[model samples]
Target: MNAFKPYPLRDDFTLKNRLVMAPMTTYSSQDDFHVSEEELHYYKLRSKTMGMVIIAATSINDQAQAFDKQITLKSDDYIPSMARLAKAIKEEGAKAIVQLHHGGRMNNPTLYENKEDIVSASAVPAPREGMVTPRALTEEEIHQTIEDFAQATRRSIEAGYDGVELHGANTYLLQQFFSPHSNRRTDAFGGSLTKRMHFIDMLIDRVNEVIKHDATEPFILGYRFSPEEIEDPGITLNDTLALVDMLKDKPLDYLHISLGKYDQSSMRDQTDQEPIAQKIQTVLKRKIPFIGVGKIETRESIDHALSLGYDLVASGMPILVDPNWGETIQLNQPIKTVMPDTLPKPLYDRLAKYRERFQQSGYEFPVEND
Candidate 1:
């Protein structure tokens, strides 16, 4: 039970195990931005066997939606559905965490009906296809976005979730603000590295303020971040190190690193050959727990990630392939690595349609009987 050991995240909360179900967008929510019955079933299937289940990146506002079926926390009207979704995970003895997100410039133009509605720290366009050039957010709008996150936190607390993870990774709004390639403003929210971090600092403060004022129980607050960016003058490893130093003293429960490989080396311009997570750990110095997520699938992979000094390991694709991953491990059963055709019809059809997209992200979603 090396990987199955209980982890104390805080004095008030402890996880049953160290294996977390990484949050992955299902694109299965209802049309009106509520959690659908299919999505609830999807979570229930995966929730029981993990220490914690992080729900997909959910929209904090209607205009911030990136996916067609993404769940929303923009208004209190959606709390009942959110509460049900949280209960589905918690009923299985897993802590439920919802990733708070805003698409920023990555938002679909048709959803807003005007490109100007899509705002970011600067007017830079995302490097991805179909992304539109965004209007730069005014200083007032930036403060408003921080309040939006605070309000979302309050709603999550009311919905009975154990924690909330800020989606500061994968080139979303938070990352956009920190990346020099995307955030070109000369205001306090951009320009220098310290300036870029202003948005995140303010966001964390506001969210913590809400948790302090409204939360009845201790609610975990986690931040997920990518360590490096590829563009010139973008987020380098040094920049990330500085960011980690700043965040280490914050009241965060954990820092989750968003990567494609657990043992991946520097993606920045640094000449050092150390693994990225190791570098981040050196900066953190155990001040906060580190949750490492990448292509962690097998028992050996989890052990290897832990060996690299990760406090917890998270899996995404493997759990999608086998919902009872931890249970199978405990029973000495072989865990499924490849997708199976015998999946519930609805889920199987949805995955089959998005098979190519998954592959593009370096995941091999092969059918078992193929």
Candidate 2:
């Protein structure tokens, strides 16, 4: 036999084929964010051959329950279903991570049952249409938010999840506080990068307090943050580095850097997309993993990124267009990507099937709020 060659993607914590399945919103959960078998099928199919499977952004706290069919790690009732999904994927020998999330000013305004007004870093109503005006969270409530994340992190461990990812990208609750356009407060939580990042800082501190004992087992504490916002200047890549430096003490397992505003103009208003991930990787000199994503498709591009020193690459459109995307790319097959929103037939069919099967059972529409 030839000299043994180490598996290219096999690391101490994960034995993936070099892809971390980017979390896509399937909206396939039933009432209370319970993962339907349909949802499990979508994820399990990814597990068949992928390196790592990160569940889509599952809302972790009650106030963050901004979408329907989005899975939850907060509810005890949801624990068994989530645990089963986790087990199903892990039994296939793939590492499983859950993306935990929240929405601040951006809570979908159409959820019929939610009466409490959306809360945020400030009390301003979202400039975008449909979002309700939000009230600023009190200091006590701020502390509660930290505890909520800790509780969710604890739940992720209890549910047998290999890791938990904080969803801090794309102008969500955390992003909103970090966005100048969304947050206009003079308080300590605003005005400066260090102050602006207080929420996430607090969240990590609380999470550490609870999970400090299990520090050895890839207890991933990764955060996805944006380097640029649509028209906002509150948080830029420069400000981001300062905050990242502040967060170094948390000793995060990964620092996922991504860009693109939350609004429609975000991707379009760009001058030149500087392949942002590489630039960020240079700034982040630590040895912790660095993950980058946004419009990833082909293997060569991903390989190029890996060669350029990105710790991991995340795929979005390619996977959405083809569930077996990674395996197909590895096998050297040509793939024709389709725009799910533009096309008439397949996209409509998938969306209808997804909604009908999910909403009829009481899953909320992600774009609509309570």
Candidate 3:
């Protein structure tokens, strides 16, 4: 199938074309996970033509939190507000999917404070310097975390969202479990590939349970995973593929691939690599949808990715710069090229402040930067 000629992500779900708005963290949602007018306008402008809109990473809870303004699905109180946001997106006719995550080893003062007890597959310190060593998650905390993701997914549906994307990439909690550099556990949750995959299995199962109970359409349960970590050198494409094999039989709907652990980019030239998400589509031989992420800004690159077997194409910096990129591309209009330095200019500045806040208070920012 020609990916460029309007592809469907699943039998019951499809995009107008293949363009997907990459899920980005814009803390437009301050104290409440509710979408603000500015964020609403931002997404509405992009939804004019984008095939699908995956809302930015919303923390499941404070522990899973990434920043102060980061949108999340944590409470029943958050539901009505998010429902409004979801309804707005659906009104645009673009499917709404929210990325749910837990910040594990990567430090985010809002989610986890000086409480060094960072849970991972094991108690391994991140390869980066200056951060306190993470405390391993007790077995019970492990179970609770899985439950948190499930509950969060359920809440997302209640909020009128059509689907949920697992924030399994970017060196977050799930990604940490997949990394040998981070997951040093000896239990069933650790050790070999199968063990490492256990966490993914549980999360997927809970998400599927929610889907079945609600009897919704083939709502997306996309997996965003990195192929390897730049700092800790233990993983390879084969390792990631092994887990992919396990997921194939399960009900995973999509795999949004990107490389390099999140924190590694802070220390090395990790961002210098081409968006590895497209390579993920090439390396995996499967019918499930695949997407590429990075500095995808032009239609030609997107079409090239479609030619390369990417069922869905995602643009990050382009969306950050012009949430109306899809509409502009539809009109064949040239946009200001987003260079590496200015790609995620908005998100870039926020993370800088987030790090500063984390260092200062080891707690969450109380306002909505979203």
Give all candidate RMSDs, comma-separated: 2.7, 7.0, 6.9
Candidate 2's residue-wise lDDT over 1-370, tens digit each? 1001112332446545557777766666865578777667666766765666778788877788667567887767778888899998888766788888887778886763554657888877766778788878877887887778878887888788887788888678888877776777777677766677778887877786766754446566778877665464556656666766666557477777663311111242366455555555566665567766655556666666665556666766556556676777777675553323332232335564555443443333243211
Q: Which lDDT value does model 1 have at 54?
A: 91
Q: What is the TM-score of each candidate against the true structure?
A: 0.93, 0.82, 0.83
Model 3, clash count? 7
lDDT of 1: 0.86
Off by over 4 Å in 3: 1-5, 110-117, 259-283, 337-370
Candidate 3 lDDT by residue in tens digits, 1-370: 4434567678787777777888877766744556666667667766766778888888786577666577778777788777877877888878888989887777553355456545556667667665556778888988888888888888887777878999888888898888777888889888887888888888899888987786455667888887665664556656776877776667778888663221122223345554344344445676677776655556666666666556677876556556577777666666653222332335545655554433342323223333
Name the top lDDT candidate. Answer: 1
For candidate 1, what is the TM-score? Answer: 0.93
Q: How many backbone clashes does candidate 2 have?
A: 5
Per-residue accuracy of model 1 over 279-307 as CA lDDT, tens digit each: 88898998998999887766777788988
Residue pairs with colliding backbones in model 2 are 16-51, 68-364, 110-369, 111-369, 111-370
Report the error of model 3 at residue 94, Å. Answer: 1.0
